[model samples]
Target: MDSQADLADILAGEPERIATGFQFTEGPVWHSDGYLLFSDIPANRIVKWTPDGKTETFREPSGNSNGLTYDRAGRLIACEHGNRRVSRTEPDGTITVLAERYNEKRLNSPNDVVVKSDGSIYFTDPPYGVSEAERELDFQGVYRIAPDGTLTLLIDDFDRPNGLAFSPDEKSLYIDDTAHRHVRAFDVLEDGTLANGRILVDMAIDAQGSPDGMKVDTAGNLYVTGAGGTWVVSPSGEHLGTIVTAELPANCAFGDSDNKTLYITARTSVYRVRLKIEGMKTF
Candidate 1:
């Protein structure tokens, strides 16, 4: 599964522009109720796009949000850069601060997040959203929030931790480092901690941009946003192919009725392409 022909079996069509004219888009997620949500970092808003091709503002003064996901209860979880926190949008639309500090010190900046099957939350803490003078943490880390609301540092050696997702079976956790431009795999322990850290994909072999956000399909193939566009890599660490868009992509997600559409969040536009294989739905 490491060739263009292999990629052809997965991709049903080429990338097609769905929406455009955003200010640095990222963090795409599909809601069960319908519609898609993504971050416009510079614009500080979460824009919503419906099936009818209409786009509107989901939230403003988004705290300069960069990443977003939905919890099991259908609540919105977001990584806010300007606020340097990971927050959750409750059912009534009230904002709840999930994680803002660790060990009595404020976090550098929460970058991306994912929810495990057990209802715990996992997120990456990188300094990209903060300045050196204001940074509180010395190292970038991967953290887990227990179901009981406990925040624990799982990994603290990454240069700049970013996007992350779990395998279909939830036994493996894949996290990407933007500074190192590589993706790493970890064996998810019973206690929800990570072990056996190893490099899964090296983006240096590709074009230019670093890996930011990523998603996994049902077969465990990783659709990583990096380099030329979104890269499709096999579970065995092979680069199958790349999905190029009009603008360089920063993140992607699987959406639509059957979960067979790959939604990409490029620099200033959003793109989608049909896929023969369905994506791994966390919820």
Candidate 2:
């Protein structure tokens, strides 16, 4: 367990500042092409950060892009909440809408997203971006956009499926239900459906606030963002410890030049810490 002193050092001290002057930020994705791409939600733009700490504009009026990931072809996939659809950023810089509706009814808002090795895009839909009465969908469900462009609902029972990530072996799926104040684990079936869901962690809503975004390390440890800080849960769901942050952390990713740095997005700043373990994904 990392002691309080160590946790303090991780949050405090000289931190890495990738850039500044952002209205609000979310959904950071590392591009091995030597740049980091993230959404400035309120600014309605996507910004890029070079390894040398230089900032540049990647896209304008990005349809309020939130979560992002690169497909097998290295094309950027984005969850556009404002547009109520998911899109792909092609190499030629053209945007392609992946999924926009279910059964002819418009989606609420696509929040966080993850891509399977098979090229399927899995994303969570919550009404956070839309007014309560404006949500056309009945429930905040998790949906999968198949490689062939078929939209399938994976599970529609979550109170609010906030952040999602697949297990190391892709046999299990973890989803954070902020309203429920717990993280649930489900069995990934052969056809990409989820079953046998059980609460993995019953967090105290008062202490931790609410679970937001998460990522799995190479060793299967789940690093989750919360109001208190970043909670590190062991593979078996043990509450290992928390990585304190200077401010309220909104989301986090495991990215660095060597892929061993834990990059955190606090309220208005981005910070990084060298980790003993590397993250599974490049970003």
Predicted structure with the largest lDDT when compared to the true one = 1
Which lDDT values do the candidates have, in the order given?
Answer: 0.91, 0.78
Candidate 2 lDDT over residue span 1-283, tens digit each:
4322444323333335556678766787777766678888778888887777788888989998887778878889888978988899888889898988898888888888888878888899988788878778899889988888889998898876887888889898899888887889999888888899999986664564578788888888887887477788777887777777666666677676667777766666666667777677732
Decoy 1 TM-score against native: 0.97
Worst 10 residues of 2 by lDDT: 2-11
In angstroms, the error of model 2 at 144 is: 1.0
User: In angstroms, how far off is 179's CA in candidate 2?
Assistant: 1.0
Candidate 2 CA-lDDT value: 0.78
What does candidate 1's lDDT look like per residue over 203-256, in tens digits? Answer: 985477999899999998999998877889889888898888879899999998
* Model 1 lDDT, full chain set: 0.91
